[model samples]
Target: MTGTGFGAFVRRAHDAGKLVVQPRMGMSEPDRMRAGLRATRDARATTVGTITLDSYTRVGDLESAELALLEGVSLNGYPIVSHDLATTAGVVEGLYGAGFPIQVRHGSATPEAIFRALMTAGLDASEGGPVSYCLPYGRIPLSESMANWSRSCELFVRSREAGMDPHLETFGGCMLGQLCPPSMLVAISALEALFFHRHGVRSISASYAQQTNADQDAEAVAALRRLCAELLPGADWHVVVYAYMGVYPVSPQGAYRLLGRAAELAAGSGSERLIVKTVAESVRIPTIEENVGALEYAAEAAARTPVEPADSDSQTYAEAAALVDAVLNMAPDLGTALLLAFRRGYLDIPYCLHPDNGGRSRSYIDSEGRLRWADIGKLPLGGLVDTLGAPAITSGELLESLSYIRRKFDCETTV
Candidate 1:
């Protein structure tokens, strides 16, 4: 815990030309969790370990987590807060190293308690964002989530001063994990990283989930990279692309095919890391073997995918830059600027119903399967939003667009 953090390990692996693959894994039982970590480490690929928390732990229901752990009831993930430090330390003691760093991941909008428990246990890395974790997950007010996260970030920074390299990953790019346009995803990712940096975090990762078209995904990640370079100059940052977080492909072959595309996208876009999905993604919870299988598949795919030259004039870059510039100029600090941007409709998310979110914007898939903004609301896109996409889509068209990828990948009658 007093050693290299997740970001530095990822950067080191990247510098050595290795694509680090990680899984969303956890088990309430300490031995099982340790076994999962060992499996991830022994996978035939460059890898990192994860201790994803259960739903109870995620929503701050620590009592339920404790009861489940004591009653021998299996939880979906590890409950770091409910489990004592000895249990967690034993689970990861010999497993975590420079070559095998671990990150604690929970989908919590309010993570103060979680952060405290992690600090006491000497864990250093985690992921979430105020807007991204709040909107899709629950009814927590956006302002409240922001306040909680601000405090958590501040508390976690103490780890850095205590000789631990604490790092965080922003879940912004994967917001709603679906039909949102690439430019919007890129903007949110950039903004959240800035928020983390303002709260005293120097090591962070900006995430981008794979969407429909490979080229569009490539452009989006490229834009994310450029924004980090320009904005996070003093912060240590990298781009991590997630496998499609929407409706997953049901068929094993389809799932693998989709995951392969994500690996290729990450490689071509100059991203340093990838979050993988297993073949069982469309069905039940994946076993450790399935996760390992997915990791190996993605690694092999990354090995074969060639990195293309960067796109200097990408439309994604232009549109995302416009959004970032508009938001940054709205207020003095990143956090207040973000809150004001949403309140003023300058950084609206499509279809997000959060109280603070200006929900006037909408997105749909174009004929070519690229996500396009159906309506840009009051976002200062400089006419770029108006120039692209079809007229506002019908409700039926929206439903079709939501199911677009699932149908393409899961249909019995294939091309």
Candidate 2:
């Protein structure tokens, strides 16, 4: 995590021509929109900035962000990929307004209902039709029991045959909420490779987010190396350097350094495209200035550092790779594999209580084999009956309060 060491590595990768994709989290919906627009403008303004992959939580924000970028930026026919449907609309509309063709992210790998949603969303937003579909939850586990994978894959084939370009995104190190772990991610990556063999994709972007510590992340990286070797032996691909800006507990300086390290590793390993995240995210929602500041930080660091190979002999890397393979082979179905991994605690993303869960959240299992819900509620001590006024208010205000928060933040947010 040394700043100097990691920064130099990132710079070297840029010098060698790699694509770096930075995730600038949105403080509010508006801020997220603004960030997306600014990203496209910045990318189109220079050779260094060619294409930007933007993410949005809601549809309106996506439209707003893409509009902002389309209205101002000029590109040499580069495309922008949005992780949300709303953002896809904005991109399509922007492209039409800018007198260019629009591309949509049609995730045909999802359920029929979801695929229909994507198609309907695309048709509603575009003039010529959607050109691309982005699958953001890393790779799809092709276990037979998961209906989503087969449906989506079939759609991908249909899309390709119809001359539409489809893209597969690969996850980086850490496991985000409900998003599978690196081991599972490795399985999905393998699945994508097999899918691509039958139906050629327009491109593959490794949207690598640095998760966990250097030790854990390095292990995941090693797993990726093995996965690539096994899944995509002779396939041509491009690399997208996704920097984990806000989530890590590390300092902004340390985060940038880690990104540099990752970029160097990717380059030495033969990745072709790279971009750096702007350095502003050390906490919740970075301002535009912070975004600019962060990107500058990574750029300056890269300029000073330059990427090179780090020590590659660690056993952690090998062990992690084996773990990934083992998990992929353990189950007959993707959903079961995923559930089994969760049962064994293979993938553990923090589960906070529903905002309505009155803030009560817990991870520890009780000795009685029961899941304990951490009570975040501030109730008077005596006992549950006492707190509820001798059980008279069992379904009253106390119940109402607990009910509200759980539904608000907990149930709605996570899977």
Candidate 3:
């Protein structure tokens, strides 16, 4: 059987009426990393493999990563550039292909080096974007990240040229993790996917992270799907939902309940893949067993829950389409259009601190816990921007909104 691309693999699962599960797992030791991959592969669920890079490598500090390796320092994630090609290849030997494709996840604004290293090590799938990887993670200048990602996207396409298809996932959807409105997330994800498609990638995935409200999240995913179908016509794409990337619940039961809801949301909203967060997420790095358990749990939740397709023609869709169109109409190309969009306030992420970001926008969770725009800057959303009604959210309310999901899930109904 000819194993199709990573995007195809997820699409096949979605077509087969299943959701593919993934974990945010990474380890510095090759043996541990290999073990994690093997465990994910053998888990009682449909899964994809991830090798998240350490902070040193993420910031383009290969020398620091190498020094930590030699000094036996415990790094947070696998240092892809620091490892030799043979070592990285051996870690995924016989593990990356067909049923399991490993995606190199690095939080790098400058991912050119990361892309080159992963491609050389025989992996072609990775995630990040010029805007998403830049604004939230570091202080890297936006233009530099844009230039780096343009080069990285071109680097990603080399896999297809080498007879191995490559996949690029956009981290745009999960920007700022929580409190950012669903419309902004959907729009950014679509824009980044367009950027990737323009850079010669044939397979891509647009990501959406679970937010405070289930109904709103479902609407956002549906909106994202519609926009992607309309904008990314020539590319193979899928929506991957990350389980609440914000403040996680401390209690195991709360964590499990939240994760189960995430799976249900993914299945109902027609997302092909769901990224799982372990019960230990609030405390520390999860073990392989914890990750495997989370995967299985998510899979089981997805199996029992019948899908309820969201309405694609909803207001969310209209708002997202407006945002996307406004940005695309700004300039001829997506890369430059994105930069100009931010500069002109046509695309503004709420609470984002980047100098490139307009910072005029703000979002707050309403009484129903649905994320609503407290201010829209100049997002070109027409009447939708008026949803930023009345008095602005106080700092205390902002704190409460940030902890909304965690507080709800962690409250005890049973002793």
Q: Pick the candidate with the highest TM-score.
A: 3
| Candidate 2 segments whose C-alpha is farther than 4 A from its true place | 1-16, 22-35, 38-145, 177-202, 211-219, 238-241, 245-283, 303-307, 310-314, 331-415
Q: lDDT per residue, candidate 1, 229-271, as tens digits?
A: 8888798899999999988888887888889999999887778
Give a tens-digit lDDT track for model 3, residues 1-415.
1233788788888899999999999999999999999999999999999999999999988889999999999899999899999999899988888789888899999888888888887776899999999999999788889999998888778777677788999999999999899988999999999999999987999999999889989999999999889988888899999999999999999999999999999988878999999999999999999999999999999999888878988777888889888888888988888889998998888878889999998888877878887777788876766763545878898788788888989984244
Q: Which one wins by lDDT: 2 or 3?
A: 3
Candidate 3 vs. true structure, TM-score? 0.97
Q: After superposition, how far is residue 227 of candidate 1 from its true place, in Å?
A: 0.3
Query: What lDDT does candidate 1 reach at residue 206?
Result: 97
Clashing pairs in 1: none
TM-scores of all predicted structures? 0.97, 0.50, 0.97
List per-prediction Cα lDDT, in the order shown: 0.88, 0.37, 0.89
